[model samples]
Target chain A: MSEPIVVIRGVEKWFGGLRALGPVDVDLKPGERLGLIGPNGSGKTTLINCLSGLFVPDKGTIVYDGRDITREPAFRRARMGIARSFQIPRPFTGMTVLENLLVPMDYLGSHERSELERADEVLASVGLAARRDAPAESLSQLELRKLELARALVTEPKVLVADEAMAGLSENEIDDVLALLMRLNDTGVAIIMIEHIMHAVMRFSQRMICLETGRIIAMGTPQDVAQDRQVQKVYFGERAGA
Target chain B: MRTLPFLVIAALILVGGLFLPQFVGNPYYFFAGYVVLQYVVIATGWNILGGYAGYINFGTSAFFGAGVYVAAFLIKAFGAPLPVQILAAGVVGMLLGVATGYLTLRIQGVYFSIATVALVVVLETLIHNIDYLGGASGMQTIAPPAPAWFGGQTQYVFCAMLVLAVVAVVAARFIERSWIGRSLRAIKASEPAAEACGVPTLSMKLVACAISGAIIAIAGAPYAYYASHVDPLSAFSLTIGLNALAMPLIGGTRSWIGPVIGALLLASVQQIATVTISSEFNILAVGIVLIAFVVLAPEGILGLIADLKEKLRRRGARP
Candidate 1:
């Protein structure tokens, strides 16, 4: 493939003296579907935080789109086309659903179409056209997830970091989000999906990485990593004495 | 509403307000009206940061008292006119606001509120020690002659306060309608989410704090002339802070109209209470009404009206 769109190297993060994440490395290729799976406290979210400019790594560098972004602010990274969805849906309350999409559009004012047209297009793509005018507080759980994704997609980011975007969603809802991500990737948008749902991530990710306690335990094609001994142990609790 | 139409309506209201002294000849009317309009400016200013940006500022007295003293200083030092005093006070208040926001905005929620209260204490102590601007004792201010049209000092200051009220309300409306308002609402909803969406949350907050401080200071600028005396105790009185917060909550925090409705209602009630009952009942009255609104219609009058309208619309649609 062409040069990786994102290159993360030797990133480390510590909350006080406790090393919560990193001393790890990662690289994301253009239009690639990268799945990151780990158990609770496994530093998946921590890594995403470091990558998205929320928490600058105590050590190491994050180069994005051919520039070093390790010290960049979160908003600056977002403007440079790094977008993310929160694990919990954070709809700008008091605004309507369509207006929620318009929030990001106000900042990234480089879109070809007007904000209204772009917002409408995003809402329709996420299957929320009918609920466009509804207040954000009135959305159901599944709809809120769609809104989270729609907001991330609205910026037209080259890389979308979806942190637990499908968590707590039903089986069919998972498939719905998977299809949305697939369709988005088809349009040349790379996605890094941090998910706890096993089967869904396995299906969506072309390549996968399994993290355990801030360290990468396995990385390769989905089948290879799923069957890797360490990943299996981490997922299934030592697999009945091997 | 569009910008031009909004400004035109604001001008019309201001012109109509200037005629109030003509209809009511009593000096007491202008006195009470001035206090009420002062609350209008303070509440609207406080709402820009407190209601829209979701940062509770418990230090209204800090900005207000600073404005009062700034005006007093300008008058005593340079024999400055009202407009110059107002302009100087606004600049000082805005600087204080940015300084406060820069130092404390990283700490969210109650911590931010607590830091603001500490700011009031710090500024009050500093002013108490400064001898030039009256110190612990008070300073008296004599007003310049009123304009030929206004006919009296109280009436003149009342019209000046009315103009500031219009300016404050119009500025608040402009903020509530613009992209800054949208970003502030987003920040209020979730700061991290707003940041992730490419909104500079801290800078947006600083802008809100600056504008809020300037308007609030402008309200306090004419006060030294109105009261004819400025003292640390009364200038930095806790009542102003409480009333500023209460008015916005009573009216609703969602839009510009909420604080205006709230300030008018609550300030009018307090005025009536001070006159009919006693000066002691003023705080008691605000306390009771605030508790009632907080427990019952927490969204203030606007939210209540919107809910009522929604219920009525739903009913009408059903049959």
Candidate 2:
């Protein structure tokens, strides 16, 4: 795949001797759809944090676009074309939905006229044109999630890490987010989706990897990973039992 | 075209201020007017960082007091003119602000506030032990003779403060409509989210700190000349700190007009209370008003007005 967009080698993170995530390796190619699923406490969020420069991994390195960014600050990483949406939507309160998108666009040092145009385009793409002028605090749950996605997209990141973008959505809403991710991926941006919704992940991911206790236990095609004895015993078995 | 009306109004205010001494006849007018204008500067300055960036600064007196001391030192050593002193004070204030922000802003939220409070104590102590600056006592500063164009020393300082107030308000208004203001609001809403979205949060915060510090300190510079005395106690008074925070909150921190409205209203009331009741009663009044605004109008007068407008629009739509 034309020079992996992001390469993670021997990444490990620990919180006071309790290893949260680590000794993990991942490579994301351009336009790749990678689904990352793990049980709770499997360090899914921790890995994403490391990738996005929120927390420096205790060991190993993260190379993005052939550059080592293991120690870069989150803002610098974002400027280098890495963007992510929060599992819990964090719209900038006291601002209109369009203004929320404009924040990142402004940071890009774009012209004021173009920034406004870009903000409009992003809002329209997210199906939030009607609510463009509404205060972020006034948005419904679904709209807030869409606003989060729009804010991420405004930066035009090369890699988008969607951390549970469909966490609390209804069945149809889940499909809607899945389709949106697919469309976004089609734009030549690699996407790492960490989701608990199994069917959505299975249908969206070109390849699936399951993590457990800071370790990758299974990695393969949807059917191959699902039918594997270790994967079913550890991941699907726990879901079925619950 | 949009700015024409604002520029015209500003010019009228300046011209009217130039002739204010002609009619008032009372030296007391300039004296009281000077105090009101001083709060205008302080409140507007405080709002830039506290309101826009959501970083509550409990050490307003530190920057203000630094300016007072900087001016006092210059006067005592080199017999610096008022203009020179004001400039020096702004620089010192900006430096202290940047230093304090660099050290404390990393901690963020309430912890950052506590660090500011600590800064006040540290600065006050440092100034107290310095005998050249009068230590705990104070130094008397006889300002250079007022310019021939002004009638008296009080009038000169009053005009100086008027110029500063206008400049501070104009600067604040410009910032409110700029990208810097939007970034600050984003940081205020959610620092982590703002960072993830590519805002250099620390750098933006430091810029806010420097501007806020410089403007507030500029306000204190004239006080050194007006009062003709400078002491650690009054220079670093906690009342100034509290009032600085209270005025912006009471008015509305979002726009420059809020602090202007708040400082004028609050300072006028305090002036009246100080004369009719007692000087001590002024503090009590400020405390009461601050609490009332915090509880009843958290967004200050501006937020309340916005809410009322929304309600009226809803009513109109329903009918």
Docking class of 1: high
lDDT per residue, candidate 2, B39-68, as tens digits? 999999999999999899999999999999
On TM-score, the leading prediction is 1
Would you list the clashing residue pairs of candidate 1? none
Return model 1's CA RMSD, one decimal. 1.5
- In angstroms, the error of model 1 at B6 is 4.2
Off by over 4 Å in 1: A110-113, A238-242, B1-8
* Per-residue accuracy of model 2 over A98-172 as CA lDDT, tens digit each: 888878888787666877888888788888999999989999888888988999998999999999999998998
Share of real contacts kept by model 2? 0.66
Return the number of clashes found in candidate 2. Answer: 1
Lowest lDDT sum, 10 consecutive residues, model 2 chain B, at: B1-10
* Model 1's TM-score against the true structure: 0.98
For model 1, state the Cα shift of residue B3 in Å.
Answer: 5.7
The alpha-carbon lDDT assigned to residue B233 of candidate 1 equals 91
Name the best candidate (by DockQ).
Answer: 1
